[model samples]
Target: MSRSAGRSARSEDSAPSDPDARSNGPRIGSDISSNFPDGGQASAGGASLDRAGAKDAPAATIASDSRSNPRNSDPRDILLDALRAALDAVGGYRSVHRRLMQEASIEGPCAAFAVGKASAFMMAGALDALGDRIEKGLVITRHGYAAEVIEPGWPVEVVESSHPLPDASSIEAGRALIDFLRRLPPRTTLLAMISGGASALVERLAAGFGAEDLARVNRYLLGSGYPIGTINRVRKRISLIKAGRLANFIASQEVLNLLISDVPGDDPKVIGSGLLIPHTAADIDTGEIDLPPWLTTMARSAPDLPPAKTMDSIRSEIIARPADARAAAAACLRKAGFDIIEHPEILQGDAVEAGSRIGRMIALAAPATVHLWVGETTVRLPPHPGRGGRCQSLALAAAREIAGKTGAYLLAAGTDGSDGPGEVAGALVDAGSIDRGQSAAPGSCPDRSLRAADAGTWLEACGDLVRTGPTGTNVMDLIIALRARSPASTERSFHAG
Candidate 1:
């Protein structure tokens, strides 16, 4: 059979990245080598190991007697390096694509629509694996990420749009995508990549709805401190493209969807607001919950529809999730000779409360023990809130707990390379974090900034903001806590093990 005839592809694209595709890590198989477009010549550079930070030599621990590098082996630096490794392990586009190619045999021309924060890398990987067989494609991503993953002269139509909230551009992109889906030649297979931010990056509103409606709802949700599931459920109710509605337009055409799950449980029906999968009846039954008046009104007024009928034609796989990131990070931590304390419970609810709880946990741990937590946190916004996101808020709260404590530090950040309204992805808070905030604002307590939603301001002043501009993926937030270990503590841990 010819290369493009019988196969299909689709991925839930929103969560985060993928790991190395070769042996010694995770490998699909060698069959993909033969499927490469252009007779195996298309470089799968986008999915390579170098992108995962493996190429950078690991930072060496400072010797106790050395005066040249007196800064000692910072636990914060070690943890951050491990965090980067974790992101890189899963954040590559090439890795996911290569995995799919190894599992499926492509026989005919294919079209793809990749949407979310990770869209560009996902598209790059798809193109590399399938070669020019990807006849037509559309990429919708947040600003600043497309340029890095999309090679010059690449054929896909690309759109950069707003995120965390839908805008007019999001509606435009949605309409364009519907048109693109409709225009695909008969019998053409589709590969749809769905990732986080998709609900905001692309949308086709239901009747009587517009961008303003979505914007208002999203704003309310953002400020409401609702769980992601609740927020996305509302989104699915209002969107013509979400909750598997997008898949309805495909008719009988086969679809293969690969997903990166940012939502807890990695449910394909929830990622990207289930752009390609429909909700079940149980999904529609959101039990007694307090929703804003506007949302309640909308929910009651919005027509209830059955889940999309296209679930049968499309096959879905979760390529990456928080667990994958945690595992990667844990591996790095072990290599660094630290005792890792992994809390399996996902962090949730108020950011500040969560941070304080975690801070207390760290303060009680033995020195040299690293604590890690993964999951998204919600923040209830006060009126006219200041410039900061949940990560900043959490960092500031932790700062209050660790103040005056010796050798304790924490990092709270979004894996997507941004936190709140600022460029900072998150913050690293130490015992000095509180002092820094105080020194920056002499009349105020550090908690004041947290209360005002201006944690970013304080974090910036303290030189604790972590900025890495769009990591090309989105999972959730990663929190790492490190307690500096003394020689006695290290020996104890070794003995206990």
Candidate 2:
């Protein structure tokens, strides 16, 4: 259809650094701290509090909050805000533990751990209840986000790894997970915080597959623009620990899984790659797994290894999910009392198409309640020699659709703050978006040029971008509210879990 999107980048040592990175001196850095109003350094939830200053503005400023980002930011920002909100909503693991013990009936001594940008927050919520009683904890996150936790005496093990693509850190984390379980006694409680990025964080290559080769395959598939399900099929086939394999090691441990879903369906077998879901008889029979080609040859040619065993002794639950985050988002908006039209998770797919679809929908709204919910759309871009992410590209493209429409409040963001490679989580778009977008992208004429995944370029032109820095999470994406002449406009929007 679209001339083949450009070749996707790999995780090689020389792979272009984060696309959102700015060259301060000779080194590149992804620092969005200065991008937000008030320099973006307020208290945890203070980011949204700044809305008061822009209140008097016409057609909310380009840098509007998320109703505006906090799920619908962009895949990157949605991922980021979801982490922060989920973490903040449940509080940290210690606080969550206290609340659960006092509020809901927590089943047992198990703890929870997540692997993603949201790993910290997911872990934070998990530790809320299990922090003190749990024997040990393990959290693996993308490199930059490993600094959020400061738990004492809980003996939580933290590992910083790569994402979308695996690296040595992935190998280390996976092996460490296996080694850590070895030290635990039978029947010990395990609180696993497995989020979207776990596929990379916990990746242990299927024997014979090198991390480098796997990275190559990932690069190829992403550029191929295949659905995530198809990509994961190949990923699961090539990796030893993905799918349900990670859960096999803790067969002897009691597991309480706290997951933050990133995949479209949030299937346990796919979310964070079903690390805790046992490949039960049912799963094994119907999972219909897929693996990489070279990997299959390796699997067949390699020496015999014991088949992975799913532990029936452990228990797991999807404590936090994309749907949960969507609900939380819906609640926030409904509380604000705008005519709510909840779309069923329009958070996934090509950034440009998703944005255009929502933009067109917002443009056509006839002053009614329209809450659209979509999830897990992807952006397949060309190999342009430029810098940007899928969310930014979506916002840029959406800007064109809503070029002349007034009174529209549209937002798109990733649950994870880091979209492909930028810092301003997601963005806000409306009628004047093109003007702002053109201004934002001073170098590139903000003309109607889809230009394929050049979100970085488009976003830079429009000041209506929403940047929460890093909310430290991943849920997929959130596209909350877009105004279309509603008779009554409410000031608040919500999605409470």
TM-score, one value per model: 0.79, 0.73
Model number with the top lDDT:
1
Candidate with maximal TM-score? 1
Judged by lDDT against the true structure, how good is candidate 1? 0.69
Where does candidate 2 stray beyond 4 Å?
Answer: 1-113, 151-154, 206-209, 216-227, 251-253, 280-293, 301-310, 345-348, 368-370, 439-444, 447-449, 484-497
lDDT of 2 by residue, 1-497 (tens): 01011111112232232211211111111112321244322222111112222100000012323333433422223222322332233222222333344434345555444576667655544443333454466777887665524233334678788876777778888887777776666766666666667777776765556667656766777676666556666666555666566655664545556565666666777777676565433332213434456545644432222254345544565655566656655554444444676666446556678777777877777653345464656666566635556666676777788788776656666556566675656665667878776665555654335564556666556655555544544666666545643323321222333
Scored by CA lDDT, what does every candidate get?
0.69, 0.52
lDDT of 2 at 123: 53
